[model samples]
Target chain A: GAGVSQSPSNKVTEKGKDVELRCDPISGHTALYWYRQSLGQGLEFLIYFQGNSAPDKSGLPSDRFSAERTGGSVSTLTIQRTQQEDSAVYLCASSPAGDTEAFFGQGTRLTVV
Target chain B: AQSVTQPDIHITVSEGASLELRCNYSYGATPYLFWYVQSPGQGLQLLLKYFSGDTLVQGIKGFEAEFKRSQSSFNLRKPSVHWSDAAEYFCAVERGATLGRLYFGRGTQLTVWP
Candidate 1:
């Protein structure tokens, strides 16, 4: 079976620029999650979608960060006006169901200068 | 509020020796506990999870975890650790029935010596 895949393995951008990261979840998965991992820090929850419905967005650090999952398969996380503080590895994961074991993607390393 | 705690930020263990990684969690109600391992430049891999029933659960890579409700702990253990086991381990807790949003700990960086 195909695992979760993420695009733009590495991205370097200037501050105040906008960047979009893509995630393709496993086939038939109904749950998708996005998290940020800063160096020497734990995984910080960003947004999660269960069948295209995001019931939890509280983990999103600010309004500049937003994510959406459409057709219950793919998800996109967009950062508007990125800041140096936003530089980190963005990871995506998906599970068969909302509360089951999750499979992860390699992650996109976003660097803001 | 729900939270996960990994007491040791780093631990060094000798190869073929016993190992244990402590995890404590704070949750209002019954909690879902999980342990994940991440190698450098890789995503997190689920080591094990404890939802309900048996307090002891087995996981991949010869790992196991015991859930102690009284102490609010779910500790991971591996009797004989291998050098390849060196990596960052994260302890997570979830609010029951809420997709277990997974509150992660700061993580424990394990170092294996030969």
Candidate 2:
């Protein structure tokens, strides 16, 4: 892809239900990142992957939230037993190897009702 | 811990007026700084970035930012504003040694009055 791509532009799930958001990073980019943006809040870092291995998962809000990336191409973020507070836009980004500017995707707007 | 601070939550400026957005960061060492703009119903777009070399960096959409190490500030500025420039602006920082983790500040909403 020319840039990072996120699927299911919007998702509305009932409270306590599970939801999955997907992100497809740019080709050959070695680093991928996930972030959550709540209303009137800054981007909260969630996790980061380097070549299919997650070196940083420090920002996952709870055990219910987990993510995985396979083949260093596509990633999935699963939120189990969603809560109202989990409603936010989930963003994904990818960058080249080493220190570089990341290109972002059109985020998935998740609404936990 | 690394963090970015954007003091102004909202700002209003008349079209054609000059504009400036302030940002500050706290990091152990010299950090990578960036400015991003998010328009309504759109994804974030990179405005500018600074890693090293010149303190001043230019970006797309006629945006520019200056990095000041003394104050740990990277402020975005434009000589003239446009109505289309109305959007939310965010400041972000990355730890040079750490690589991929990027920290962001609370955004600043800019309202351009015509």
Best by DockQ: 2
RMSD of 2: 1.1
Give DockQ per model, in order.
0.63, 0.75
Off by over 4 Å in 2: none
lDDT of 2 by residue, B8-109 (tens): 999999999999999999987888889999998677888989989999999998999999999999999999999999999999988854476778999999
lDDT of 2 by residue, A23-113 (tens): 9999999899999999756699899999999988999999999999999889999999999999999999998998568889989999988
> TM-score for all predictions?
0.96, 0.97
What is candidate 1's lDDT per residue for A14-112, written digit by digit as tens? 999999999999999888889999976668888878999998888899999999989999899999999999999999999887456778898999999
lDDT of each: 0.90, 0.92
